[model samples]
Target: MSGTGEPLFVADGERDRIEVLHVEDDPAFATVARRFLERCDPSLEVTSETDPREALDRLEEESFDCVLCDYDMPGMNGIELLESLRESYPELPFILFTGKGSEEVASDAFSAGATDYFGKSSDASEYEVLAERIATVVEKYRTERQLERSEERYRRLVETAPVAIAVHRGDEIAFANRAAADFLGVDAPAELIGDDPLSYLDTDDRAVARERIARLLADEATMESLEERYVDADGNLKHGLVAGSAVEYGGERAVQVIVRDITEHRERQQELERYRQLVEAMGDGVYALDADGCFEMFNERMVELSGYSREELQGRYAGDVMTEAGLETVEAAIQSLLDGETDSVTVEVQAKRADGEVVPRELTLTLQPTEPGESFAGTVGVVHDITDRVKRERELEAQNERLEAFAEIVSHDLRNPLTVVEGHVELARELAEEGASGEELVPQLEAIADATDRMLSMTGDLLTLSRQGDTVGERHPVALAPLARDVWSTLDTGAATLETRDPGQVEADRTRLEQLLANLLENAVEHGSTDGQSSPDDPVETPADGADEGLTVTVVGTADGFAVTDDGPGVPQEDRDDVFERGYSTEQGTGVGLAIVRTVAEAHGWTVTVGESAAGGARFEFHTDG
Candidate 1:
């Protein structure tokens, strides 16, 4: 194209420089030819080589854009040099400029890989043809190299892409990348060649996939991303978002499909939906606020907890629900999160109900994550009504204080009087032994000593009952049968038999449960007598008409919990309701034991009740389901 003498229009400045190598046998001829070529095209820089051998050496040393050589040479002709140059510099432009003008030589120049041939004579215009040929060939070569580089970069991009990409040609896959092969459960991309892409889609999605593929292949329009179900080679169903567009592949129109595996994303979306439903139905209040602390979104539970309608709470500030102090605490926590000081925080606050009641609440606030340099966005909050919890904590504190006072009384007032009584009784016994007057007082002194001992025992019982048991922390699986037998062996029962039936394991505090069993068994041994006798070793000589035949205590597991029963005169129906009260006893026994049993049961969140057993005895049933 440049040989027609039109401008080549190369870039301005130094980029227009083109180097040319000229080989001729004669020094004068080579010199004149180089000057003529340079004068014709100011952009060309021509170097002369007298011998073809020297020209080959120069080519190996330096680079040139085009080569100009003559036909006749000492070692090698122009065509022969070109043949050798083609081995290493195959694409370098070579032009034959020789005085021997023959069809035979022209044909030989081209067949030997010369780019262009021109016959040279005494004509100065022939040099213009040589310059034109050099410019045209060099421009074409550079452009073709640039295009190859661009194609190489595009190939790398497609091969290394993150998402699955496949090109389909007439219902069969022509190309697939590694991501596509992995998504389709194939070992390599080559394995997917000539496979129908539609075969990977699930039955319900095949028709939609076909329609979208048809639209793209027909050059109608591109299809937007659509979620569809597909099956892998392992027959496991998965979710993908597919988008398709028409593309040229191997000189034919084809569909290039991009599939992004959305299975995990879809599952996460579904899980969030389920959590959203749960938040709406939960008893605690869940709400979101903007950076200014104005309500943006809230669950139904928030409305109920705040005693405000959706219309009333929407767009309202946090001050509508929390007091000023609580709002300040929440704001401070949010600032801490925004400052990267903490992840989340829980603070106690007072919430004002719509009914004008201010109740204690525990608010847990967490700031939503944002970009590193972004300001605080908002906060998600969960509010728990802690009114009942606060009240219970105060009651437990008072109960502990009362127990401390009772312990002080037992240790000082009651013990001092008992010690004095024992000292007097010993002195009276010593006086009787010394044959002093008033020796008859010895028997009365012994009786007083027995009463003093009984008082001491009752004092110890009071201390035992005062203990409400430590906080029942972390319940564990405890077997009941072994615990019952172990406690029964430590008791002072002589004839009272113990039995455990179907006493399975339960989740309970082991130490507290053992204490409960000990107290209950002791109560049974003390009252399980038909003749209303205190000692289990002493038999009832003349049994009452409708009394129990013998004392027997049994512990058995129930569906909801467990039961402890004894074959004795059952507690009266009138006294059943008050039996668990402290210091309430029917016989000559401290009621503190049963009261301890009730305290332990309550600590474990179990309800204890007194009823008549099947064998006409008092049954204490502990239900844990509440």
Candidate 2:
């Protein structure tokens, strides 16, 4: 805008610092141009190149506000240089300060995108005019470059923002960022240009978005965030939280909208509702307590397990529900979690039930965080009743002690007398053979020897019965058919046959399990059938056609466990309950066989029951643990 020669000297304070690129064919003239340009305004820095083509290459490498060149030069001229630079940098200032004073050349300079034109002069006043023009052009170029840089930074920030951002003029979208385009299911931001934001919303929410936009433009309300549903390109409803505010854009009032996706938050709310329902229906007590051990939250199961109403437990301390001993345990467990010694702790305590009975219960506590450093904020607890488990353990201990006493009695008391009686029978049989009166006493001596042998046999059974198969430590999957055949080998059965049908695997201790199978086999052969035949070389005779037919024993696998069945006389229904009684014997053996089988089964947490087999014989069924 500096036009007249006198007004050109009007200074706009001190001029801004700028670098200029000057090109001339003469090295002496390039030096003169730098001197005068710096003298006009001390803030200007001028770089000169004698070769005009090299100057253009310098412009491409280095940053400069403006380019100064002569109109006439060898090979490429100033107009040709201006035309070449225009291809990439149209905003760069190119001024012609040449010796050629032709109006036609000046017209061509401006047409090639020259910023200003000046003719070379030896006059000192001409250099001053040219310097002022150079300063003005460079200052204008620097200001426009700074504006472009600032807009570039803002554009980058909007494009990469996590939330959707769009600038709207009236109802149409003027600009949109990458996130905004993606939210609308478009490939590029330009596709949203001239599109209405309301069109992306469902029909139900479009009016709400319109009303909010109207209120923002009218200045009737301050900026507010709201949850709404927007429709994507596929017409699927998408949940979002959006905020809109009036902003000055493009020299007009426009709305700048920011939207955040909230579909995950909605899904989380639904999940929490389902968890609440599930916890309320649980059987074990579930509760949450604060760091001070006061109840913060609880489920319906907690009220039932603690024997307290919801009203009573709402603000009550958890220690009040537990006894002094229980409180001691509770305090230690909570301290362990708070000190970071462990993440969770479990302990057993006595809890008072609603019926005034103190039930044995186990409580488990887990650490939780309310804030970053305050991870000891609260503890989640689960209480489970263990009364039955405790009672069964005590009964098992008492049963073991009784078995130990029985073994001692059989070893010391019964064995000594039976051994002495067998010794006397042997001496009497030897005396009867040596003397004449001994012939009559030989049968009596032999009868006495047979009675002692029977007594010894009964004594051996007593000791074996005293060895109650109590504990079975680690159980393995034992194949029933092989184990049954092994057990049958140990038993003295003659005509009795062992049959296995689908004898699948059962988890049991092998040695103790063998004993169980041996007892079951003995019971089947001895007491199962009175008419069952023994081996042809045996002394025991069979009563023909009694309750036994084939006298077959079967080991069959059941769903939960296995069964040992027989085709002999079945136990009467009235006597089934007393079959496992300790001293109840029917025929030749100590009655403790079935009782020992029951003991071993109990140790493994199995249930033993006697029922009639399919062929009218006794079936011993064992059910495995739950």
Candidate 3:
């Protein structure tokens, strides 16, 4: 491109067409010159104008690569035209070809900035010579412009780069970017120019720097970065990573180096390594899960708890090792934290092991801490195995249940028998004071004795439950049928009948099992009566008066254990769930009978459930496999 008002100049070799403008005073001569130039070079496209002033007007309106003009004729001479064109189109190629040949005219044409000066003659070869001159001047003009544009682009790239960039010409700094100046604590890159680059590096690293520069300039394919220390403008030491390669700068071999300050980065890495060691040494299982709920980090304790190796668990989804219910619980907790509803969550879940075993575990989860202005990345959790703790809690609960039953008996059951005894004693006193017959007094005494015996029996049972605390002493094989018959004989069942069917042996604590059986039989005998009487303790619907009769209790063997069924009004469907609770009675007796039965069954590691019997009575089923 011409610097004087032209858009851009297409290089001669690269251009598909070259346009030329010819100015002459004679119209015929201008026409002939245009034809001759075009014929000499098919790539040349020429336009002829007779008036020099008109030629300048055409040049202003159109684009051309080169201009040809005559030395003399008409209003302006070639020297005058060349001088006038130079004012506006300084870089445009111009050749002065004239029929008037003189040493003075040629010297004036060149002085006026003509790219070439030639004398026109009668020889036909003159046109060819002029054509070559036009091509040479235009190509040189375009080549110079291309090189200038390229240099400008490279300069901009170096100045704006983030890392420190410097070009070393021999042993002196030929160039330095803004970043290099800032890194060296200088006000501007000009301050670093012409200084030895080695002067910036520490004395200890100067030798290595020199060797590296030599290797780079030799083009030995050195791509490795060097860690070197430098002295800033303030005379303080600093660290950087430097990389360099051989390059050409201003037609001279040079080494272009890029420097990155990494002092802070190295310190941060050291701090992180310390934290990693602390985490690995923790006792409890610690784990970190990424946003996708996959394991990103864990300690040795975590591997042991999960029974999975580090390689197996890394990047694996958490759901793969957790039970479905547990995974859902954890997911919900994570959502609650993300919503800012909670800072942390602790939950007990079943962890499925690689060996197909389920282990009870407690986990405390919290969002991983992040730097300010950073988003939530993942979760951190600490795991604890709570199997032993859970077992102890169950035992404590069982003991509490027993204590509750004992309190009820002492408060209500024992008081009732004591009140009965007091009433009978008062009646006997009145009978004696009125001089009643001895026979009448004897019946009152017997009633007092019966009440006293009942109180004593309840006291003994309470003492046993309180002292034992639901703990079974020892286990032995016992026959169910004989045990039931023996317990029935001891109970004052009134008119109730007992039936045994398919008796079997069960491993149990004999003393505890017998007490369990006795309580069940007593519960049935006391409540299974359809006597049309609703005791204060039993709040069920009373049967019809004529329906008064004793009920039959049956002991039946089951595949896993046994059951006690009674043929009487069955327990209310709504009340079955609470039947074994302390103080929940459906009969005329202490409400603790079934509660003791449950305590004993649990102590023996058995499960008990109450349901309706086929004969419209309550059925108590005991499973030994609990």
Candidate 4:
């Protein structure tokens, strides 16, 4: 098979042995043929057989590289003997040596699988040519036999490989092994023998996969190993890690594909994604650094906390966006983790925002170690923004001090004066009732009572605002339909029917959700209706010019969350953001209503924006986490 250094035929001067079985019934012709073959090649090994039956028996018992037979025998002719020899030993070269030189006989000899046909001749040169032809036939048969064995061995190995193995010629799969057939969900390799491999991929991926394969074949280079998905015969999907290399098979250039199943690996990857989502859903910021102390990955909260885009954080050093002091502290902590002195460390540090503001963050750093070592592979950090929390703590401490001071002032100064004033007023009223002129005393006493009531109301509102800031109540999915009904029922607008649209559910605190609905309903009732004039008793009658028509508040659910639209005068675009600010009121409002709306919305991680409504009025669109 591998004709590396083998000679074509034996040289003339060498002691070559060519076994020739001369089957001739006549003694005279047999002697003549023997002498002629010896003259042609002096090293010829000629053996004459008079009986055709004996020669046929010898072929079965012994092996010869070449056989010579004669035609027109009594028992068995040359053609019949050649057919028998071919069936038993097809690779052994056979030459027909007969006295008959008819064209019909030569054609019949070849048809019976004879390597060559030679007849009796007196010329020595013609006999030499016959001998040379026989030598060439023997060498050719030997090479062909070796090639057959090599091909058989290769076929056995390819068919029994564990992984899918396929040979692709250009775009078609020329040959696919048994494993390839099973991987493709086919019964046998023959089913995919001539099919295009790219047909197994999805339509979108077929063109790209084909281009990659073509490029690999064109350059005669191996394709890099990659994880890819393919559709099987049953229309089910299969994931695999595939590697391809260019090779020569069956005298043609082709590519070989080796594929390993990786479905379990892909499933594990999906599970990791689910865990990552659970972590990102938390309020606190979380991030991971690589072994080189670079920001490799982070959650959405981390991006919001730092006020930096994910693209900007990736590949950047961890200390690049931190304050100078914070950077030094973080670096030292990381070094400690890398040095194996700590498994995890927590510290308070300031993170510098994109706008150059330094926000205090409580950072908890844990060393994520590599396998079988104390050395750190990276660090996982959970950062909590404590700016508002710290501010609230200080404010609570200050409020406690103020409350104590207020109590002291009221006990010693205000309460004592109030008691004296109350006694004086009572005495003056009694004297006035007894007919003493005391108009000024009566007016002063009423003024004191009004001032005291006003003070109490102011204290109650302040306390309510403080409590709202301190408590983050239980949050759940609040159905907007019932909440809107409750707020609408409390409205005091006479003769006005509140039209409520289908507002879907939102995740929010129960009380805060109720408060938000209450504020919007009250605003629609108070400002949406006319200032003073009353409407007619009949619902069909319209009010006067100064009186307002009944307002329609439409609440619609959106993909993001919900929207509330009022058919009232819309706010100008320039004042939309300012309207949400504390103490910003256009209609002499206490200005705490919209501010409370904003605070509650923000507390529940929702966004509220003002825009023009479909009714050509102010629309407030709010979104909650769905």
Best-matching candidate per TM-score: 3
Task: Score candidate 2 by lDDT.
Answer: 0.76
- Model 4 weakest lDDT span, ten residues long: 532-541
Q: Count steric clashes of candidate 1.
A: 0
Off by over 4 Å in 3: 1-158, 165-259, 272-410, 432-442, 459-518, 521-557, 564-578, 585-589, 600-606, 611-619, 624-626
Which pairs of residues collide in candidate 3? Answer: 1-9
lDDT digits (tens) for residues 434-464 of candidate 1 = 8767657766676576557556655666766
Instruction: Sort every candidate by lDDT, greatest first.
Output: 3, 1, 2, 4
Q: Which candidate's lDDT is highest? A: 3
Clashes of each: 0, 0, 1, 0
Which regions of candidate 2 fall more than 4 Å away from where they truly are?
1-397, 400-469, 529-550
Q: Candidate 1 vs candidate 3: which has greater lDDT?
A: 3
The reply for model 1, stretches above 4 Å from the true place, is 1-359, 362-392, 395-470, 530-549
lDDT of 2 by residue, 394-458 (tens): 76776676566466545644454466667767777677668738566766566566556546655
Q: Whole-model lDDT, candidate 1?
A: 0.79
lDDT of each: 0.79, 0.76, 0.81, 0.72
TM-score between model 4 and native = 0.34
Off by over 4 Å in 4: 1-238, 243-245, 249-251, 258-261, 325-347, 407-626
**Candidate ordering by TM-score (highest first):** 3, 1, 2, 4
TM-score of each: 0.37, 0.36, 0.50, 0.34
Report the lDDT tens digits of candidate 4 across residue range 36-149: 777786556677888887877776665455787778899788898888777767667788876699999999988888888887677767778887877787667767876876
Cα TM-score of candidate 1: 0.37
